[model samples]
Target chain A: MYGIRHLHLRNPGSWSPFEELERLQASLERGGVALGGASAGPAIDVWNEGDGLRLRALVPGVKPEDLEITVEGDALTIRGTTAVAGPQSGDRWLLRERASAKFARTLQLPFAVEADAVKARVANGVLEMELPRSAAEKPRRIPIQTT
Target chain B: MNCEMKNGCATVAEPTVAKATPACDVWEGEDGVHVVAEMPGVDAAAVEITIERDVLSIRGKACLPRASSRAEGEMDAVATGYVRAFHLTDTADAGAIQASCKDGLVRLLVPRKQPAQRKIAVSTG
Candidate 1:
């Protein structure tokens, strides 16, 4: 949706050249749908944490109850609808710029995360999510045996 | 709606002090005029609304979260605040205005005053 406008392609060390091609292909497909002007979603900011990743999405005028978040594999999806009440039959509108529509955005995480450990909260129309890295993906120290 | 005088002087002073103007929508109906503005990341306590004569003003500061230690070079610091004002007309009843904020959206209702109707007496001559 509209939030993808701020997607920064940082050097995520894990992706291979072949995976990059697949990601480019998927982004092109998403661009095709986004160009239709169906839904201009909210703005989002993604940042890298030491042991995890954090995401913040701005969705004003949308109720928390209407949001649906799902994590599948390495992808995180957020779906929600903003509904504004229609004007009455006899009412004449002076201005009508506000829009109401359904939006869905999916982002591929750089590393595998603990699905159950993910934390999310909605405050002041901003959705904040913290995805902790999986145990297997965390760095560990290995001991060396002297000959 | 005549906002100018014969001397070519503007009656209302233009608002040029806002750092960032937020998106706003105004609707007119039988009840009166309703205004909705989007102010994401702003808390209700930080919002300020005032009405001086025919001018309605809105100002708020966005409470953005600080960057984590690991995101020193990855994130950019940008201003995400809003300030806006509107010149109202005589049709608006400034005294009866009401406002509320929820989900980072502020809604203002300004009720219109009803015009007084005069009764005329008729007699057969």
Candidate 2:
């Protein structure tokens, strides 16, 4: 889920009270998930678990040092830059299909992430993370007695 | 597997099952043609590259843990794996093909064939 329930679809003539904020959120989400359009950044898979979320993003050839991950509230942002490979300096390219750019994606999760418990690592051109839910955001089981 | 069916694969290509097509870049330079592909979740040990006749096949089984989830992009191959193959040109030399897989990325180089060399004898009449 993109957090917001109502969003003005891309109809040029449409406008609403939350239009400005929705537009900004939608644009930022373009990097996060493909809600209704093509994703500008890497493909991501987010699983909403009972306690937290598991996220995976494809980023081949991107080194760990080149990535920047930051979390604020329920939103998590992933940014990276890639270097295109070549046989030599003056090699002629026959086909260039891979993305070679500075890209960033921000995702809005359902619960606040425990920053200390979150562990992220890059392997085989993919970024994987486990975001544990904050204690305050976790649901507590209340005891009940027969009355 | 020097020769095969029209598809160039000695191993049977499963027509019923769909596989993930990896994103790749092909360039001609240095000794020959080089190809690079982005295949996340695939490891070096899991990558399979086969050359039969003029066909170069790349297949990798990518296994990732995801249970009861909502995802995006081509998720089918996450369980089934990735399948891709290339037909080599006549000028390419298959004998010296060099390939390496690292961190879910595969790079292949097909060197150009060396030209025939022969010395012509000159006679004085």
Candidate 3:
């Protein structure tokens, strides 16, 4: 048992209770109170894949019709509404972590984008987009010959 | 103070280990107690619910596309999941709790038990 535990300690990918606490602390420091404070933007992640750039946003309960995705030049913007009905006369709220508000966020991409070819979809409360690079933006190669 | 007020009362404190708490909204209403959690990558088939004693727990596993394998079986993408637990009061019919998931949202409903009323026969001496 001790040997296995020691092996886990050496594995960087393994999760530990201390690391979880540190992660929680780090998140709290990065504006934890912004959540549910009125009009907080949804969490978004954008990454560069080999074929194109991919972006995803966390917007649970947001109907697809309510989301508007736009890409201009190298900037991408997502706008949506998240609404959780308030408690009625006989309803008593215990926890209100989720909120009802309009959220909008824009992020700049690292390279030129082919806005016309961008594809976007929302599913299971998540929005995903595939952004291609413009043909003219691709790097041109030069060849040289020695006599 | 009604310490026994259980149905929709949140557990005393937020568990510090809520790595991805999956923003939740819990409420108690005439219909029942409802718990809605926002779990981005989770699907209807990926949710799990369990009950023990007075506690009810919800866990959802988000499914990500196969991570790009780097050198030596190293994965580039890590899955982040959502988990939370609640304490159910006697007023809730734990046996009849219903849960549903859509597009990445999980909603749970625990029906409330109406206060039982009884009539006692009068004894004439």
Candidate 4:
């Protein structure tokens, strides 16, 4: 059976529900805060394949040439910037909820991976990456000897 | 925190329902009104746009890849479905609406209908 698993590693130390609530309340009290400044990391999804892992990230408005990916040992890092269109002279922004800024995310793999075998592709603003396991990490069986 | 046993392994409780409202930007230009929606992980073929009367609805489903092995550790998962709707004004020409999806972004164009101008004749009595 094909199974899919996700690994979520968020900065727990810096985030709290109470703090988020307080910030929301403060923004409401101040009428409205200016958009931007806050850099929330993009959403990412990881899949644990038998011999490798797959990662998908949402990066709308980001060009393929702007993305940079690196894999070293068990750490995989992705960095990119989303272009923000300049406002036209006569145009007024009614709403601006989509985030636009330079963002970086690094994920720690559960096991070592083959850096050379990694492949990545971007389509429709989503980035997909495949990381293969190292030769030594493949499962092996040992035979018992009876004396 | 809630936990459940799935396939003999204890797993964190996951929200069964996916309720993701995609972010959107609406603006009017000299040509027409434009609506841009950000829907990540959604393919161009999976996007569905429908217009009924004055209501315009957009729906998209993301087909995330599957893994062969069970996953461990804690990770946040993105919603796979997106939905949003907008109301069109009387000046909007629904028949001329056009939509395009690219790089996980969907753009819709709604052209405005021009009102006919008439010159009234003035009679001097």
Q: Per-candidate TM-score, first chain only?
A: 0.68, 0.68, 0.69, 0.67
Tens-digit per-residue lDDT, A5-24, candidate 1: 00111223333669668846
Q: Is the docking of candidate 1 incorrect, acceptable, medium or high quality?
A: incorrect
* Interface RMSD, every prediction, one decimal place: 13.1, 15.7, 13.0, 15.5
> lDDT tens string, model 2, B98-123?
88888678988778878789999999
- Tens-place lDDT digits, model 4, residues A1-147: 011111122223334669668856643442221234534446676777657888877787788998989998888878888775533667545445566677776677877889899999988788888889977787889899999
Order of candidate numbers by TM-score, starting with the best: 2, 3, 1, 4
Off by over 4 Å in 1: A1-38, B1-19, B69-79, B116-125
What lDDT is reached at residue A116 by model 1?
96
Measured with DockQ on alpha carbons, how good is candidate 1?
0.16
For each candidate, the alpha-carbon lDDT, in order, equals 0.65, 0.69, 0.66, 0.66
Please tell me which model should have the higher TM-score, number 1 or number 3: 3
Q: How far out, in Å, is residue B31 in model 3? A: 1.4
Query: What are the chain B TM-scores of all models?
Result: 0.70, 0.73, 0.72, 0.73
**Position B9, candidate 4: lDDT:** 26
Q: How displaced is residue A125 in candidate 1, in Å?
A: 1.0
What value of lDDT does candidate 2 attain over all alpha carbons?
Answer: 0.69
Worst 10 residues of 4 chain B by lDDT: B1-10
Better of 1 and 2 by TM-score: 2
